[model samples]
Target: MKLPPLKTLPVFEAVARTLSFSAAAEELHVTQSAVSHRIRQLEDDLGESLFDRHGRRVALTEEGERYLEAIAPALAQIERASQQLRGQSDTRLRLAVPSSLAVRWLIPRLPHLQRRHPDLDLTLEMLADMPVMSERLADAFITIRYRQRGYVSTPLYVERLFAVCSRQYWMQMRESLEDAGLREKGSGRSIRPEWLSRFTLLSAASVFEKPGEDWRRWFQAAETEMPPTARVQQFSHMLLAQEAARHHQGIALSNDYMLDTASDPELVRLRTHEFRTGDEFHFACKQSRAKEPGILHLSRWLERQAEASGWR
Candidate 1:
């Protein structure tokens, strides 16, 4: 049996699904006239009118409804098959991740990920911690705490906050204390809680002001108060603030999940106190795409990586 023009089927499907010639035309990037012409041509080929039209309104006929139900899945399958033949089925995965996490964590582990999935094309986009609901933004997003409604979210790790500074800076503090004979004579090194105000506080744009993750929260957890006049330098993102802390510019509040423990010898955590904000990293995507092999495979790999690194 000969098939009708292959191109018209997509146009027919678009129109039947939308029930609007203009809408189909907009989606197909063509004119309303083109959509009408295609539908009319498709009807002529099948010897059946697929829609009932009045003015700007339209509805699928009984035959159109049946045809849509039949062909939609077939078209999707064809598209997937074509992608597979072209080596793109499960080959490309686009991910949006927090900038800090991308830099300090994901990028470092990416080589291992690439080795494990050599054929997979991974595109990473750095996004700040914000609510992104549109699926068009990314195939999946890795974020902290926030999950867009209607998306399937897989937990990665709950986070802990720490005060971090460069070894050089910590040594300087110790030296200054020793010169003044204020250093406690022992291996124990703990800065006084009030000393936090003496050092500049470097902060990320969003997390620093977040209710449960901010300077106020950390100080509250420590049973202290941030000095009202404490010198604070705010960066547009956490990665920037972290870099500043690495250079001994100031003390930065670091998220455990976003820290590269093995790599940053310059930075040291001031284990004087710790804070947990109850926020966690999550991998989220549209529910319809959650069970796709690519998504599931990557999610499992991420879970393992996080667990192995004690990130979870």
Candidate 2:
């Protein structure tokens, strides 16, 4: 039995949906000429004109209308079947996340996610902050939601603020415990809040695109004032600033979710109470897409990971 060129159907669907060859080409990430060629090829095989071309516009002929009505559902079924064979109804899930979370949290857990889902394809798009989801961009986003709406949001975990430094810094200060003004608390040394002025501060702007997520808030929670003349090194992305602190560059103000306690033994959290920020990490997706098998699988997996992260 003769089958239509498998590739042409998708091109035809794009053109039929948009009613413009150029638009279909842009959506398919191909040249306009390529779209025209596929349409011509498909029409030749079917022995009927699918589109009636006018000066600068095109319209579907009666044959095209009938053909599309029959094939579109079949194509959709084929896609669904392909996904089912791969273990999910939506095989590829495009997820957007903040850069710091991607580096520190998500990437590390991806191997387990892949093993569990097997056939699900997870594409992560790292952004400094979450953006609005679109068909051409991310299908979902994981970040702290402020006022953004129009999607189903599932809260994963709340982020709290803490100060961390390199283990080397802790050791060096221990050697000069008296001069560094370190105090003993229970079984560990703690830095005096006022002594913060002696060390360089590593910081990042709020990854949430809002203000006040910085060292100042951590100090404010302790009811201590940050020295006006304190030295600071600012990084655009929180991941970089956190890495700087891990490498002994300076003290960094970090969020709970961004700290990977299992892997990095070189970093030490300051012996101070943590500040709970009202913001939280959430998985945002279109209400329609949320029910898809792949989306559901990933959303559940992420929630479980968040639970294990000890921040919930």
Candidate 3:
């Protein structure tokens, strides 16, 4: 038995499923006349009418319906297989991340991602200082900003920022006090009452931009007044600020998620209480890419990682 033309079957399937020649044509990116002609030819080949005209609409006949049930799945499978093969050729996932988070959190987990998806070509790009979405440039993005309207955003975690310093800096301060004959100073475990008066306070540029919620804000949240004339050294980026703190350049306020204890043991948290801020960590992607498998996978993975890390 001779088989019907493969090309005609798709046209017929589209018409049969939609029951509208115009709709099928629009979906197939062809003229309505072409869709009608293909269905006519297919019916002639099969020796049966496929559609029953009802004024402006069409309905599939019993035979057409049965044929559709048989062929639709096979055609859909072929289309999906083609897409999957194309996807393998373009397996790269472009991710946009904040510079600070990239250096502190995501960079450390990259080895684990590679082990899980050896075939995935992962690319990481640092986001600009301000939050912006570019669909053409990134497949997904992570941001630490307030919710913006008109974008699909998923809250991943809330971060708490606190002061951190290097262990060496604490030891040096202890030695300096002992040498100055102030060894009788309060217990070395606790910060000296005049400690803020002695050392510089390092922070990111964001702190200055939001003066209401700077290092002084955290101090106020702890029910303490801002220290008078505390030395301030601002870095252009959060990672730089954290790095400066790690090297004992000065004390810096940072989020726990931005410190990799496994990689930098010298960094130690100074304040037990965290500063309350409105900023939140969220995942944002264009509505168009929301349903994509890769996007969904990464979103879920990040969520799980956040959960495991005890992020709120």
For TM-score, the strongest prediction is 2
lDDT (10s digit) by residue, model 1, range 1-312? 889878899999788767889989999999989988888888999998899989889998898887776687577558767887887665577789888778778888899988997776889977865655454456778877446676888888887777888998888766766776766655476776667767788877666554223667778888988888888887766667778988989888887755665777788887567787777788887786777777777788898998988876
lDDT (Cα) of model 3: 0.73
Worst 10 residues of 2 by lDDT: 178-187
Candidate 3 local lDDT, 20-50, one digit each (tens): 9999999999999999889888899999987
True-vs-predicted CA distance for residue 147, candidate 3, Å: 3.8
lDDT scores for all predictions? 0.78, 0.78, 0.73
Clashing pairs in 3: none
lDDT tens digits, residues 1-312, model 2? 899898999999889879999999999999999999999999999999999999669899999988887787577657777877887656687788888778777897899998999989989888864555543457678867623645788888787877888999866655565554465433465566767667788878664343334877777778987778888887766777889988889888777667765577788887766777677778888675678788899889998898887755
The order of the candidates by TM-score, greatest first, is 2, 1, 3
TM-scores, each model vs. reference: 0.69, 0.70, 0.62
